[model samples]
Target: MGILEKIGDIEREIARTQKNKATEHHLGLLKAKLAKFRAELLEPKSAGGAKGEGFDVMKSGDARVVMIGFPSVGKSTLLNKVTKTQSEAGAYEFTTLTCIPGKIDYNGAEIQLLDLPGIIEGAAQGKGRGRQVIAVARTADLILMMLDATKSRKQRTLLEAELEAVGLRINTRKPNIYFKIKKGGGISYNKTCNLTHLNERLVAQILQSYKIFNAEILIREDCTVDQFIDVVLGNRKYVKCLYCYNKVDEISLEEVDRLAHEPNTVVVSCEQNLNLDYLIEQIWYHLNLLRVYTKKRGEFPDFSDGLIMRNGATVEHVCHSIHRSLVENFKYALVWGTSTKHDPQRVGLAHTVDTEDVVQIVSK
Candidate 1:
């Protein structure tokens, strides 16, 4: 059978199989197999892989965010509203045939926003440029999953499944597991905390399925079999996602209130311009960016624009961000902010920086 047929068969078997101690191992293996087949399908044949064509757009700004939804679901409208760019919105399906790019400047950070073509059922199966669209999303720092307020909530589930099938884990953190493969040593399993979901033997079996014979596995947290498999696969993308329900003007206040209460969800009406600023604020917060101002030895700090860094960034990270050569030449950084114990404290490269911190690099 073909790859899709094989995947379908495995999926059917997984669905038919009951969930219990007796079936857990079987289900795990089947899920692994299914994931393998899906990967194979998404993998490009040539070394260069599939070209972006119309789907590929150059990434700009401090971070990239993509708008994903079914066609005519107001994704284009929302993009135009937020970024002040024209992205061809209509009342028909597939109004956007390619990726449309825009920018949202908030809090001194320029965020790139992309409006992509509608995703359909079987998108992960390469239906209607879905692979290309998802490829764009893989490069994104954040994914805005736009949904129609009038449509069934199941659409969100379907979109999520499509993204997951292609190795994108939304709003999920990476499993705290360390796995290393050695040539000679046999399987060594170490657990720092009590594992309620997985045991050593089952982990060994899963590792064996991947042809990992001599490896060391460290489990720092209580994770599931699927999470373990993800570590073994080692190519999954852990990204943050915001569920945006558009056309809220068409819905009732009760419905809007209900969706607002959902975690990581925003209710907005692009036509009515409802809650767009709040949405932008949430995006800024979730991006978790830090603005670090650089100062010279004998002059004042540059306050017009600050260097944007990700949260938990260190002084060394700032150095590297400025130039790769600066890391090697770096001596220490003087900081004046909440991250330092005292004002104008001299810190080393390992010192973590906080937002609005003033940094002055002292080179050797």
Candidate 2:
């Protein structure tokens, strides 16, 4: 159960309470907030393995990849192409009624991926269930604006415009800029590249880098959402991934090349199984995450059951994320990672860790 489930429970309770005409502060606020909460809850959850892109157990940079595009544009097909997911794919629109998650192995690191419901025009007006998916885009590390290359240029523009309305900018330009630079070469005959999303803070004076503007999740470390979004999307040093182009089975190699010229864009065919491996490789490198293994007595530990924390996430937060009492009783955490040479089972809370470290928290 997520925040929505809990909000739903409260709304249902308030509705039941209101049936008898008990309109108090709690009930009144519930009434006012019910609609918003419902919208947030219905935002197509990507509850999948390792973790869903842009979704972590907490409100942090745990997972980082989300796919948003028009319906039937092969978003779910790409979801199945990479990551640990078994989502449904079809020839018709809106086949994926929910957001699905998948896990992909990137150079020994675990990268989370999300496949969301399709977006249609006027989604902000709740047109064709677009509003729901727009909400989910708030919780992503990166957004993949999947487009139909086979569609006419007018149709593609229409899709891009719809995304723009939702505060997400898709990279669809040809004249090269600083989004993704060519590996080798200077000013003379510099190969043009197509970037997947609008990654740069500003593409030029007229263009803002295209991306989903989910204002809620972009909170500063102190809880200021606006500042947080600025840092995540605007920070050039942050590890950003690629924009995935799917459904290439019906398109031409030349078209794919044209798209690849955009910054961080990859061409793939989920239907015909083309270039999927290369796409994964690019995504892994862009994410910049690494995995280290931990074993005791030559046995693997359960990551799900195991409390996984980021390198800087406080021990208190981990305790709370696992169970509140640990944080309430709040002793220290006994970490078991590369820092400890003793038996893996015999480490203490003060031990710092390297990546893929296994830890055990000791509390009263």
Candidate 3:
């Protein structure tokens, strides 16, 4: 039987099975099996086939964001409106067949925005270049999950599921589980805290399903079976996503207010230019970027433009971002901002810097 058919059968079985303390281990094994089969199906075919157009786009900017949704959901329009890029927008579906790139300059940071081809149901099964589209999204710093205000909410669910199937965990943090494989220690399990959803036996069964016989596992937080499997697989992308409900001008104020209250949701009308600035602000906030100004010896700090870094960035990270050689040739950094103890406090490469911090690198 084909891999998809087998996967379908297993999914049905899982659905039919009852969940209980006695059956938890069995269910965990089934989930692990399903994940393994899906991974196998996603692997490239060994048999040579005709080469098709590739969707790989060179990433250019401080950060990259991609627009993803069903066709005719105003992804292209929003891209054009915000970034001034001329991606064709139409009333018909599938108007965008390729990746269209644009740049959004906000607060001295350049963010790359990509308008990807619309995704449909069965995308995870390689239907209609859906895999290619998702592959591009895997590299993004953030995903803009656009939805038409008039469309059914089922579209959003389908899009999220398809992305999840491809190992994209949206708006999720990495599981607080430390997993290591040993040559022959016989699977040791440790938990720093109580596990509300998983037990040791079920975790062992799931690990065995992946052929992991000897490993050390540590769980620091409450997590689910799927999360454990994700850690074991080790190819999942944990990314932040913004749920953008476009064409809000066509909807009622009550509807806009309702959507605005939803977590990580932004309601905007690209055609009417409504709430675009707020949307941009939310993007900047969620990206958690840090802007650091650089200064040379006995020179004023450059404020016109600053080096963009992710939150929790350190002086060592700054040096690496500037040039690899800087890390080796570096001595110390002088910081003049909230991260410093006194005015222009001298700090080492390990010193973490905050936004608007002025840094001067003194190297021999």
Candidate 4:
């Protein structure tokens, strides 16, 4: 089911539990969680759920979206441009001190866009705060690695190989228990990072430089680079990266052209504001979300309490999202969107609504 439905279901369950005096106490806490989540969903982009572990809100699917890149690239710049988020977009290295997020309208859907601290050389080996880098990478749905167009192939290649060796993964079941970085130097075969530069550039070279260490944290222990490729390309749900080759203005035309066709990427120059519009459009297209509106009427739903939803969403998702009991005894939703009477066009529990559509659901 979609997040809207899930939220309704949560709300429904919360209501049902509230009826039982004994469970009311526990229900209250749950309600708070869902309410906060609901608010996060309704709030503008960049404002997200409560930090760390437990039931946080989700967009299309569960995976959190993350943006990655070498220090000094335009990761934050892109975040600001796309989400309208004011991420500290500076020209120096390591400007992003922490993970920041911004929300934007993507064809009417909502997705979490996270900006992580830039990865530095030796990140996997505890350089430039490697642990934190992996921590953020672990929580990402899609990873957008920003490669500086001005940097030579060798410069990019070395960092790529190191990241591969570190093994990017996160174990949700454990509280940062399974995270680890692999060690590498010589052309030897190690469990962490294997090196056999025999095959060279096209395939083997990439394998040597792009493979993950032991990604058994969330994925199968046997997962391969092809699987990682799938995850980045949006097969796992979130769009791989709407790739951007930043600093294009500084690089030669040939380099910019090379980056444009390099695997999955788009060209942009933050300095010159080159092709930024196209880049934003690319992000919007990949996300496929539409803009929806929320309104307050008379004494509208206690949205400040954080248990409301957009017009098209059903009572069930909201209820379950609020608390599980509401779902168990969810009578029926009485809603009014676009008008006070009620919308015959308004679908039932599993209906999808659009932006600016006003709705109210009356439920037991």
Q: In candidate 2, how many clashes are counted? A: 21
Best first by lDDT, ranked: 3, 1, 2, 4
Q: Return the TM-score for each candidate structure.
A: 0.93, 0.47, 0.95, 0.45
- Residue-wise C-alpha lDDT for candidate 1, range 25-114, written one tens digit per residue: 778778877877788899855577555564869989999998888888898998888887999988889989988999999878999999
lDDT of 4 by residue, 1-364 (tens): 6445665677688767645546644453444344334433433366577743322223433234667777878888877776767999786888988767776544334556777788776665446655566555545555556777777666556655444434342211111112222464322222333322111122222323334332222222333333333332221222244456788888788867767886556788876788877765665544333333333335554433333243445545655555678566655544544432455343445655543444444345
User: On residues 1-364, what C-alpha lDDT tens digit does candidate 3 reach at each position?
Assistant: 9999998999999999999978877888888999999999888666688867868999999999988998899999989988968999999999999999999999899999999999889989999889889989999999999999977789889999999999999998999999998999788999998887798888888888888999999999999899999999999999999999999888888988998999999999988999999999999998889899999998898899799999999999989877899989898999999998898899998899999999999898
Model 2 residue 241 CA deviation (Å) reads 6.7
| Candidate 2: 10-residue stretch with minimal lDDT | 216-225
Tell me the TM-score of model 1.
Answer: 0.93
lDDT of each: 0.90, 0.54, 0.91, 0.52
Show the lowest summed lDDT stretch of 10 residues, model 1.
45-54
After superposition, the stretches of candidate 3 with alpha carbons farther than 4 Å from their true spots are 45-47
Candidate 2, superposed: residue stretches over 4 Å from native: 1-62, 153-160, 168-241, 291-364
TM-score of 4: 0.45
- Scored against the true structure, residue 132 in model 3 reaches a CA lDDT of 89
- Top-TM-score structure, candidate number: 3
Better of 2 and 4 by TM-score: 2
Candidate 3 Cα deviation (angstroms), residue 199: 2.8
Please provide, for model 2 over 1-364, each residue's C-alpha lDDT reduced to its tens digit, 9 standing for 90 to 100: 7655666587578657753333443443443344344434444366665733332223223456777778888888788767567889899999887777777755444566777788776665466767657656655656666777677556456655554434453332112222232333321212134333222232221111222232221111221112222333332122233566776677777887888788777877778898888877776555444343323334566554343344554445555556677656645445556555754544333444555666556555
